[model samples]
Target chain A: MNRIAQGLTLVLLGAAALTSTVPTDLYLNWVKPGFGPFLIAAGVVMVLLGVLVIVAELRGGDQALDQEDVVPSGAAAAGDDGPARSELDHAAAEYAGHTGDGHGHDHERAPGVAWLLLLPVLAVFVVAPPALGSYTVESTGGSSGPPPRDENGSSRFTDNLSEAAPGEVVELDVQQFVMRAWVDEERELADREVELTGFAVPTEDGEGWYLARLQMACCAADAVVNKVLITDHPAPEADTWWKVRGTWVEPEGELYDASEHEIDTSSVEAVTDPPDPYE
Target chain B: MSERTTPERGSAPDPATSLGDTIAGGWDDRGDELPPADWGRSSSSRRTGTVWLFALFITAMAVAHAWLTDDLTGQAFLAWATIFTAISFQALPFLVFGVALSAALVAFVPTSAYQRFIPSRPGRAVPVAGVSGALLPGCECASVPIAGSLIKRGVAPAAALTFLLAAPSINPIVMIATAVAFAGQPEMILARFAASLLASVVIGWVWVRFGRADWLRLPSRTHAPNASKWEVFRESMVHDMMHAGGYLVVGALAAATLNVMVPREWLMAVAEAPVISVLVLALLAILLSICSEADAFVAVSLTDFSPTAKLAFMVIGPIVDLKLIAMQAGVFGWRFVARFVPICLVVGLLSTFLIGGILL
Candidate 1:
């Protein structure tokens, strides 16, 4: 039994290391794209654990058997084969209900069926499936499609650039228009739009930006958003909800603010309930 | 010389007389009748050999898989490894808990305890048992054995059957997981709860009206309420662990086959309407036999389908997947499993569709 246990453990471990070359039947075709890598890790763990468990059980059983074998043979010849009873054994002999004694219940020991688990267990380890990908992403569009579009042609923004006069209260809702004042339409307030209302989130460039509402079909876990890069602006504490009505500037190319220096703009007030909220 | 037995028995205290006196003393004479002390050792060795043979078989298969799949593309290798690991790791702790619990139930609980929980009226017992499932939480794989034990202990068939169906779904852990999976979308959770509850209740009633008591098998012995819980627990856990573990292995293999053989690109080509949607996913769920705990993660990833369709997948897989059907068949009679699975599948499908449509 010990040799067999050892042999079994070694073979499984070795199998875990062996790379299967069968191309067609090995990998699943319909699995999600990124799911494969994770599957492999899981398989290796399973194979190792399965072997460890069997080996441990085998060793434990062997030791118990060895101890039983050590009982003196002379006692057997004297017609006393059972082990010497201990005081603890007597104490422990509280009459528990019948434990498998004379129960006619036909519970068959599964001698061979347990091995059946191996085939599938091994298969899953060997043929790790892939994760969901672009197809899934693309298929998930609806009234739940991309975020709500602003009337100003931008799909995910608060307001187009609109220059506000100094001390002008632009009265921003933070949910509607883009921040910048640009294009042929907003040519009136171009070059100085200010203070929009939204959440303060970090931009991809590691700088602070005011990112506004975007509705996702699912939960916030998959929320898509639109951002307006704010430079020369005092960083609005990250994740703080604030209502800012700042001058919108088209700036030069696609740059967010023309104020080169981080805008230490004033009138950054935190407010609740922006009207006409998107999402 | 102490009691030279045989040939007048050397005044061995009249071995057959005195009735109960010297009960242990009588065993002294019997013990010497054996050829040797090592008689049982050979049997133990044989059993050990069998266990090893099984292990070796598994190892050989693994080696074959590795050799055959060695040439798999980088994507393929990653795919294989990730899925294997996820299932292996994700299911281990739960399996351990469930097996241990089942063992405890068997070892400790008295046969009559099952009756205590059973309702007096057929009319009353069925629904109570069905709804009472909220109390015990786990997968169907674990539930079947518990249900079987109850049946053996004289639990009302209808009630036990209801419990068998509903315990896996109505449990708090599953409900909470469903709620979180949908993420703030309470509607999905609501739909699931309503659908599952309705389906289970319906099944309970149907079982009461039409069930055959003989369909289920009972354990050989009746248990006393005073039975030691720990002993029962150990036995149940060991027995059930083997059964559930065996089924899980079956499921994983089938899932792997579907995963490897079916191309994702081709699956996407299918239509996404309710009919096509239900059919495809139902088939997949049947074939894949993913565990109920992990099915949610899989559901979240099936982005191509409607929320309603995915709901059907989740609801149906646990109730009537290929591996589950097989396990049920093995434990219960095939005739019983055959009738129960299809009924459950239909009910599961219809309820999921109706509920998902309204909510999603």
Candidate 2:
């Protein structure tokens, strides 16, 4: 919590931000793609502020002593519990008074909690945790269909599907496919051979598997699972990315409340993960 | 007046000193008091030891990095770490933006400017401040310190508190994001705006009428008397970031743990009940600590919940999430947050039900 520690924490955090954003796609694992510039800007500002703190401390040491003589008199005259003194100042004064004899610098120390900033810095650099995958999908009960339509019943997902010819193999994201299968009035996914890509999550029944991808609104923390239940195919190892050519198998009962949708696959191919993992 | 007029005379030598003099001259009237002298030689030896300690810690972490990553690849642990890191990374830039703005208020903007703009009376000022929250385009992370700075600059505490709650939720970016997330439901956007604004204003009034000044802890001013405004700006920015960022980490950790542990099915199971659904989602909003800009998508995904329930999620999120709670405790004393959060929650839920019932 001393000035040096505070400055170093900032520098390391800034460095972590810079490394995550600048030369790599590491940031995509955590946040959306648009935050790159903001991360970089913040990184620069943080590094600068940190360097300023350290430089000021090193060079202005003597000047600090000169000013200490002036602080207590002004603060005391402001009165111990007067409206003029902030609660923070009162706390600081008590802290200063308690440690006033040995640790003359206690007032300059940031709250001890500031040390916790180092945890994220260490987590980022050490763990380098991967993006959310099948574990998230399986645990979260995998993607619910898209947001409900307006009262007018306009479709948010099937607008582009109108261009697709019947019987053609149409490529779609796992999210788009789920929305069309469940809510689209056109049933654009029905009877069409649709190609989709996602990591695989085995069905709870152990019969087939779900091709799942996490759709993140802002960051991995808010990611929601979107998956297609691929029937009549062997489940791949969990989290393995695949492109599957399949046809939608309409559910027997009501479409809206069903827990999962079915897709009968004609083909499945192994593929590397996409550049942007989340939908 | 002379200081305002002769700005150029001070500019020729040191740009920082001149900028400091011109912008901070108003501060001179407040009776200068330098920051505590402990900032000087008292810590040199301790400083070296601290630096060495930091170096040792980093080296130890580097040594453990491979072993930890290898052993800690369990699914839940990985998910937890990813979410924790994501929340931290996503929130930090916004926190920095808040700190910068707050520091500028302390270092550059004069107290007189606040007096000029805001009405003196807490009742009138509260609503005006609530509406003005639309101007800040960022999320909740940016608003807390900005609110704290406003209080320090002599804005009515009630008004500043109003601005804090209202800014993150009613801001233009959040509104547009809500529109896009809810897609065709224009009413969702209107309802959120109305509910959040009303709730914040009501809470502000509650604070005004019954709130005690002693309960609030204004952020302490820190800078040497003769320090340049740039120095003040830099110092305060660093201090605020270190302070707030640490609490943000605590919030993010708690959120990640809950997010990983709590099953989505439990939420869906209760999505059928009318009253319980609203309360559960409201509580979930606090627990999830999802950013306001993104909470709409999360809300929209919970298609099983009633629209009013979704409205509760959106309205309460920016005002009283785990992260905001942690940051508030750091900025305002715990005494204030202890009283404020419960009242804010109740008012927010009431506003949501009223607006959502009428609109959705």
Candidate 3:
């Protein structure tokens, strides 16, 4: 019965291997989810092991079955000989010793628990995490409109960037916007041109603007997708690279909106994929 | 069937009885003198030769794999990640523990002491083994050899098997890692705890009821004589390091493959189906075979999946996965692993679903 069960298992494994190909992880997950590659490979290996085990069990059974078929008389006597008897005695003694009382040695085996030390060992290997920064602002669903601009066609780093003294035109560094999260108070910069670098993401609203830009928080898990609303400009192609100088404005709400904000679409330039492409 | 018949057809005395003849023949050749003191030298040398050859082959294959490939795609990444994970995971702390623990057993404690507590009946032993999970803490790599030792010591097979299944899932290290991975989300910890506990208990119960002890043969064969405690410790350590390390490498290679090869955008599109999305994330968890301690971090990063779905993935992963199943099968009997794995899976999933539903 055990042998039959084993064989059945092998057949199942082989069948699974042969027919499945949404990729093993995908297949396994669809059937019974797990960690992708590791789980798939482990499953494949298990099937292989099942095959080997079934073969071994069948062979053992075959031997036992054959032994039963043999006639049981003088044939057995020939097998019991002088030297063989002594060897058997020795074997019995060894087996007896094993079954006897020196189990203290088993206590020695507890050292395997020392591997619990590995948790600390691993902690030492992976680097310490850093603080979350500006690159994450837009992605966090903070502002909803065009980013705020400065006097000289550049977006102001923050609403507090020296207030541009009424009429003085200033060329703001595009990189400085990374330090602050855009808020509604900065919406007065509308029609004031400012340069910026970001990748284009398609928006379903058809108003020609959507949340675009690489999201990053700590690592990438908390990555916030920044919503960019473009009303006046042509619809940017999804996944295309872009360099645009646009005015800041307040736009209507969308997904995960925190501080409702918008962007007045301005001069847009389609560009190539950027080097080291991320905020 | 044919192969089985052919080996037995040789005109030889019953092999067990012929052992005496073989010994006597050796004595006759030596003119009744005692056997040589160093018979082990020849065997050891032969073993070393095999080991060296295997090492050479592995080195050659690794070099070729690194240099020869150019167009790495989805399949390739999967293969590599699996291999890497398997090798590294095996070598990591668990390997060290396997050796150290084995050594401690051999040196400090008497093996027979186990007889005092170990139950003779599978029925009683199975639960004890499963609940023993509360005691030993670590992942599958560390639990296996310990289970093997328990078996060699005459512990009920079902009980030992239960201990093996539960130890990895409920270990403190794994739980803590899960907690860190989920960060402020308290429910993640609860789900993992509940799921792992439930799965372990179910598997233990099944083993007690239907498991056959005769299958635990390979582990018993590991009882070869070497030397002192240092030798046992060193040999076991080296053995586990190589074996577990090999599996870790396989696992990592598989994970890296998935990360680089599969298109994430396509997966995201598929994520629109919430049921499929949860299942997909769970599958990724298994494939990645991240150590239970680290899986939380990976689970947290998957932004597309719902928190409840991700919770299921985290909960189910450590207890059951492709890599763990494969490793367990190798160390334990396939029959045992097969029975245990399914039971655990069902229990783990159910527990996670209930907990996640309540929390999320």
Return the lDDT, model 2, position A159: 42
Q: Model 3, stretches more than 4 Å misplaced?
A: A1-279, B1-91, B112-137, B222-229, B238-259, B265-278, B358-360
lDDT of 2 at A102: 20
Which candidate wins on lDDT?
2
DockQ of each: 0.07, 0.34, 0.03
**Residue by residue across B28-115, what tens digits does model 2's lDDT show?**
2111112332435445445656765766666666667646768877899999999999999999999999999998987798778988
- Tell me the number of clashing residue pairs for each predicted model: 79, 1, 100
Q: Point out where model 1 deviates above 4 Å.
A: A1-108, A119-279, B1-45, B51-85, B217-232, B356-360
The TM-score leader among the candidates is 2
lDDT of 1 by residue, A1-279 (tens): 232333233223223322221222222222222333433443333333333333333333444335434543223233221233222112111111112222112122321334454443354444433332222222222111222112344332334334445555565433233322322233344434455555665444556564454432222112233344466566665545566655554455543323221233455677654432223
Model 3's CAPRI class is incorrect
Q: What are the iRMS values of all candidates?
A: 17.1, 8.8, 19.3
Instruction: Report model 2's TM-score to 2 decimal places.
Output: 0.87
Worst 10 residues of 2 chain A by lDDT: A94-103
* Candidate 2 chain B least-lDDT 10 residues: B13-22
For candidate 2, write residues A52-135 as lDDT tens digits. 666566555445534443455324323233353444233333222221122233225566778899888787778887999988
Q: How does model 2 fare in lDDT?
A: 0.78
The residue-by-residue lDDT of candidate 3 on A62-163, one tens digit each, is 433233225232243233222422221232222222221211122112112223322211211111111122223322332333322222222434334456
Candidate 1 recovers a fraction of native contacts equal to: 0.12
User: Which of the CAPRI classes, incorrect, acceptable, medium or high, describes model 1?
Assistant: incorrect
By DockQ, the best candidate is 2
